[model samples]
Target: MKFLTHTSIAFILLLFASTSYSARIKDIASIQGVRSNQLVGYGLVVGLPGTGEKSSKFTEQAFSTMLRNFGVNIPIGEKLKIKNVAPVAVTAELKAFAKRGQKIDITVSAIGEAKSLRGGELLQTFLKGVDGKIYAIAQGSVVVGGLGAEGADGSKVMINTPTVGRIANGAMVEKEVISPFSQGDTITFNLYESDFTTAKRMADTINNLVGANTATMLDATSVQVLAPRNISQRVSYLSTLENLEFEPARGAAKVIVNSRTGTIVIGQDVKLLPTAITHGGISVTISENKTVDQPNAFAGGKTQVTNNSTITITNEDSRMFTFDTGVSLNDLVRAVNEVGLAPGDLMAILEALKQAGALQGELIII
Candidate 1:
């Protein structure tokens, strides 16, 4: 089968210029101090159907510790047959401004050599933050989305991950991490993507809405805006401010190429200088045939096999094309389609242009 060229299989996205569009401040930026915190803890899962760890020291020690806390002690050097319990690591994300007694979801993952946690129940575990302070307590029946089965002949089949599970609203917040949002005189809005033009435009937009000097552009990422010191008024003020719409700067010129999938995307702003390029490929084909040689009747001669091979080579006609100075993306695509170049050839041409300083944009290959 003949391979398809770029003109046949490649996807070209051409973004044409249109009317200016605006985006809401909340869609492009976020409050600096409003973010989620990661919390983790070590615990155990119980009530497994004989799929738990059998000889893990940590699992046994954790089991022993729990029993000791319950006013029971195990005799020294006595191995416990606790195959119903498995040690696990519990994790949860504590969102900002989470109040005490609020329920949050938690994930339980086995840390030992347990076969599965399909029907396990996580014990009470204290989830802590980076500062080593307990933030929430987790305890619930695990819900596993995976299934596992083992045969007596040492064959096993599994889907998803049986050793990991999640419990919805299983953890209750026990502490609150203080935030500086209500304590500061000014609030900062940080852009998700840093751009000096976007930052300046945001400041200008705010100043136009709430009068001069209301917002200040600090850098490429942050825009500090003056607000009421009172928490209630500040909340209302930010609510109004974040919903305002304004035009942000366009992204920089870039060309992205997926090497594995042969997908090439050229940004609208990408420009090309005056340059000439030519591309072609050579195709080689080979074939073989076999035949048998038989002796005549009563001749007593042995039969032998004969083989024949044939090879053919074909070369594509190379074509040279020129791009004028300050060429747009549309022109580049039109020329490539007219020449019927494949995606691989186009990628090579783009890289060569970049090396020769003819491409006026960034080229990224993934």
Candidate 2:
């Protein structure tokens, strides 16, 4: 645990040192209203080999409807035993300014009792946006990366997810989503992680490059900058602005503890106030034994058995440490390493410190 702690801290320090904790505008923020939109629709996947849904009512109804649309009539109340088709949900992302005939990838997921979607083909499906408007048409052969097989005795071997598949360049866009970026006189940059200081620094960086009062900090998350109305000039202007480098403000002091994996991450700014902490452990053990009495067999013509139990307890020597006012991360690490505490023990101590108002950072356990 001590080695792991030291290694994590060293890696963090190396990362900060390598980049000087600076980031480009393109990496930290995004152009507002210039993002991808989600599209979804119900579709069907076919051409499976005895691995499709058998008893799903929705799959049957959908299959019948498709057949009817193709001029085939089926008698009412007749169940079709189709074993090569499965109902699926298709999803895709429509990028901003996507033109007609542009191809995009799509994901197909089984929504029935299908055993596998391998070697299946998705039929022509309409991918609709949130407003229920068709934006693209999807139809392609599914490329499955998972494998699945089932035995007659109900045993099955599966790897990854057998019911989901993807098709690259499967959907062709048929409509363009209107964006407000070209309509407004100013383009807004939205920070991925909002910080007031970072916003001010970003605005200042842009103002220095373009001219004074060119970029205005609208809020902690948004920075509005004036731009040309022409699309070509606007595009060139954004290309230059996004590449500009600036130093983002440091994040707040925080300690994150992953309870499941026993991972503790302490930020560089995390400090400890004046306090004392002691940690120890106690363990208990119990054992059971059985014995037989032979004297009862001779006197009463019967033998009896009795049960016995043993209990033991052990405790380790308690270790205590004190922290002065405004102790830094290095000092805390040194003290914890000297005390030989495991990750779980360290987590307990951190929680105790937070409760006692001695930790000068937010302690988050996940």
Candidate 3:
């Protein structure tokens, strides 16, 4: 009996060890009608590092006009000399059912010729939603990720896009977006990704957790759930339903390659078919050297322009390999990596393989 118990424990451990991780419905699906709304507004950023937007007539006009609203009316169309201001568009996300007095992060993007938004303070600006309704007020210092400098002679510098910036907890939610929580007898759930298998699994999970007939899969992207008639018990139902565990269907394996970065990511379950592959890299360089030859001691005429240029072209090719299809992803990755080709080269090879139907996995270039 002890031996049988030990065998069962070993089998259970083995099963656990072989289980693969899958995205859960709780992690991928949101409760029906629960989402954040996008809010955007045009505002200004003050105190920049002289990289602010070029003095546009409209920029100065707006600045002067705004100042006039504060009882200091500067004449419109006057030449306003401003050096420390940058016109920016402020944007923020208004979470679903966000209540008043809640703080949210805001992003400030430069609209003018501002070199960098660094060390800039954004004044209190009202954020409006697409419906043209003011929902929140934002005020904070902008944080840019770029810098610049000048030198007497031509100087080299780095470009990190100093125009865009972000402000953490910069906006305050003043108005709540009206989302009816109790509008009907049923509530719908939306999956983050459209997966038929996941949708069905989620519906089954919910039904099993609540009752036999409470949830039904509507389609690959949505699930309709019949809420409990007792509103008081609905919250409890949802709480337990999200925690239910079940294995998700294994998705198709894929390979994502970034040609520019020479990056290759192999998804689980990637399979390769038998194929012959060969790749080569060729580099060409052309350089020109200028020389000046002057006639000395009345030797000849004036100096003539002399130019020397050289062009070099070189190429290295890899031997063709007949690969076996149906190889596991790890083996395939190891074999390909052993070829010593760069990521960019691998990307081209993957594209060719995919076109030839030699690779069974989906190849996504990003």
Candidate 4:
């Protein structure tokens, strides 16, 4: 028998158990025109301890601009050795319906060659949206989650990410993103995952709770519901509609295989066709022995060194398992477990079964 070696088996089986739970409309879908906007800005980080960028042209230009704004101008082409400042990019999400003076968290990332952003403070920066409008202003002390230390001999030790930092409530919203929630007499709910069955069920549930012809299924992902024209009444109607619960359609059967980590995720709806599987393993071992052969003390003969190597191969007897038609997921799992096959072996077995049309589900390998 051919020998197969250098095989390491590690199994992480994720079996999703089937459960019946009614989910609320709000948990499964989101109202149209209710979303956050991304805002980004270029800024500077100051007060670093010799870890900032030393020779970045953009950093120097930004520093010069800021100084000129304060009525302090340096001679043209004069190099300033400001090692405590680093150019950075600031970003934040402006939440929907955010009012003026509202505070939001901001993320600061080094855009220059800064070694670390620890002990740095972000200067005032205006964050702009996709439309080139300033939506928020950010300025605060950065809180880095990582730490680093360096010695004189270029030895360095670091933990986590020392270049990125965050600030809680670092940005103040100066403008609000307009939403169309209050303008339309009918509101549309878009499901996170588009499914025709799910959309129909949601529409039916809403119509039954509110009234007949109150909800309409627009497509596989959106459902429109009629609401009162009055703003106060519309709010109350939405509150009632979001809290109503209904069972969602079962997801499609799928098996996710991670080739790198030896992980297999089996869906609850997976079924097996009638088939027989045989699993076996072959192991190879090599042994080496070294010995020195010396002549008798008075013979004066040269000594010799000898090396002996032994190779052994063993193959386990293959075991067969049979599955009847319409085998459920639980039964398939129990049968596979009884075989006591390693993860690598099981992975190969699943691939073979998929190819042979015995597995009644999609097999996705990552």
Candidate 5:
């Protein structure tokens, strides 16, 4: 009786529970008329810790070329020995509706063979558009990702990846990105995650708020809306439409397994069919301890090598547990894990189950 009650309560919660929270239309989709433009620039990173590019002629030649364009004449073949300069590539996105003077964040990556970018300063870098026009400039102290430490014997330790860094609000826009919403009578809203149910619900929500026939779902990917004929009114109309709230559709059922980290994440929609699974593995660890043999005074024994070795082989080949006729996803995972199956074992088992048509959901391995 207690088991039946608990199962009934859990099943009810699963049906009534919200899979997703409410989000504004702008959060789930984008205004077809307005979008952010991608902007990338090639520039230089300077003030690196003595590990900048070496005395390669191309590095010096590139630096001299840029300097000459800045109206500095240091002769064509002068040996410029700048040890702190490192070439870099800077890139950023000029967001949609970004004004002429607004600031956007930029990411600076080391393109050269610089060992580290800690405490480096970016030079005056121009971010150009695809049309070869300068739109913004980036120059700031980089924020490296990790810390580097070295032991007394020159052994080093580092975490994450310090090779790349970011600059918050680093680039200031000089030219405004062209996003004009004054021409079109209809605008299409593109959902980042396409779902027919969510798309229909969104269209219905918009039409209910602004009366019938205001918004129509063109297909599962886009929803078309009729804006006011006037430019100012159209802008205001679209702004209101982008703020309406509705719940998004549930994503596709999938089981994502990370082999490197032994992590498994199963979506709510994931399911399992009635199937028996048997998986086993073995872990053998070999360890060695070295010992030096001492020679007795009168004996003819020199220094000899004595190794104390140990080998442990753990084989988990227990009897397979029957899943019965009714096995839920959570139950299947728990049953597999009861035999001390590791993450990779679970991944392999899932792959086999998928191949055998026992796993009803998608299995994605990372």
Candidate 6:
């Protein structure tokens, strides 16, 4: 038993040690100007089994336009009863430096009152960027993550979202987006989360790996690194820089409370000042009793209705506790748990502590 216990303890410690180490630069920051662009377009979905939108003027107009493009013209004011088709808005993210003819995935969402998008195929659509320039053409069968079925009695069952679907590798790039990666002798790295300590540490690590004065911290969110003037050498330099690993600085102490879900999260650096706390609850209950008042048999009075009401208030006994100076997060959690407080009560207590200057951390309620 002793041996097994010792082995278990060692395994847990090893796991923690492995996860507490430094992270790679590539995982913490991204090179500036190397990001994806959003593209969107209006399209139509077909092949739905009577589940498509009905009486949609936009869908009808779009269908007419498509037919006219195919050299089939319909008369003016002609209404088409196309219940198997739906108008959809298609969107995709064009990755940086995507070459022409590269295939990308696209998302199609119903723009009408469609019942479901299952078993639908998106027609050929031109996806455009924010500049109104056509970037790619998307067309393929959609794969919906949800399904639905309705009975003749108006009862329906659904799973997930039925109005949205995806098409893997449905868009083929028609144009290439130019990047300025090789234009300058320096490249900037933007941190995912802006922090002065993290920015400084990253700069120092890069400087130590490459050379002195090779990297500089521009601000809490950006770090500039000198690179080779040659494009080939710059690629190699960035590859090496991204693989470097270093420990990041700890973040500020904070407590996050979710009011709707009654969830509370405390940071490791959270501390409590020397203070005393007491917790209790008050409950008010109101009850009503209905009865009938009857007159005596010989009296000529009619029976009357009456109501009896009662109100009660109860206050629970509170327990008092004190915390030493610089109480750790674990100690605070343990003490609170020992008092058997719910998350809602814990939120109230934390707010009170913050107001009284007893909490040494920022309290954020969402």
Show model 4 residue runs off by greater than 4 Å: 1-16, 282-311
For residues 1-366, write the lDDT of model 1, one tens digit per residue: 122344333324254332368999999999989889999999989999998988977878889999999999999987987678889999999999999999999999998888999999999999999999999999999999999999999999999999999999999999999988997789999999999999999999999999999999899999999999999999999999999999889889998989998888787789999999878868999999999999998999999999988898999898999999999877887788788777788899999999999999999999
Instruction: List candidate 2 segments past 4 Å from native.
Output: 1-19, 282-313
Candidates ranked by lDDT: 2, 1, 6, 4, 5, 3
Q: Which of the two, 2 or 6, has more TM-score? A: 2
Using TM-score, give the best candidate's number: 2
Please provide, for model 4 over 1-366, each residue's C-alpha lDDT reduced to its tens digit, 9 standing for 90 to 100: 011111211112223237677999999999998899999999999999988988878788999999999999989989987689989899999888899999999999988788899999999999999999999999999999988888999999999888899999999999888889888789999999899999999999988887898889999999999988898998898999999899888888888888898777777778889999988868899999999999999998999999999999999888999999988776777766667666677789889989999898999999
lDDT of 5 by residue, 1-366 (tens): 333344345445555542568889989897775877778887777787775676767678778877888898787678887567777788899888788888889988777767667888888899998888999999999899876666889898987666678999999999986665666678889998889999999999999998899889988989988887797888788889888999888878787887887767666676777777666668999999999999999998799899999999999675576555445655754565456565566678788878988777888988
Better lDDT candidate (3, 6): 6
Structural similarity to truth (TM-score) of each candidate: 0.87, 0.90, 0.73, 0.88, 0.73, 0.88
Report the error of model 3 at residue 254, Å: 2.4
Predictions in order: lDDT: 0.90, 0.90, 0.77, 0.87, 0.78, 0.88
Tens-place lDDT per residue, model 2, 264-363, is 8888788899998888978888999999877753476667798999988888878999999999887887787788777888899999999999999989
By TM-score, the better pick of 5 and 6 is: 6
Considering lDDT, which of the candidate structures 4 and 6 is the better prediction for this target?
Answer: 6
lDDT by residue (tens digit), candidate 3, 324-349: 75876646555554565555666778
CA shift at 75, candidate 1, in angstroms? 1.2
lDDT per residue, candidate 6, 1-366, as tens digits? 333343344334534543557989999999999989999999999999998989877788899999999999999988898789999999999999999999999999998989898999999999999899999999999999988888999999999989999999999999888888888889999999899999999999999888999999999999999998899999998999999999987778888988997767777778899999999968999999999999999999999889999999999988888999999775776677567677777799999999999999899999
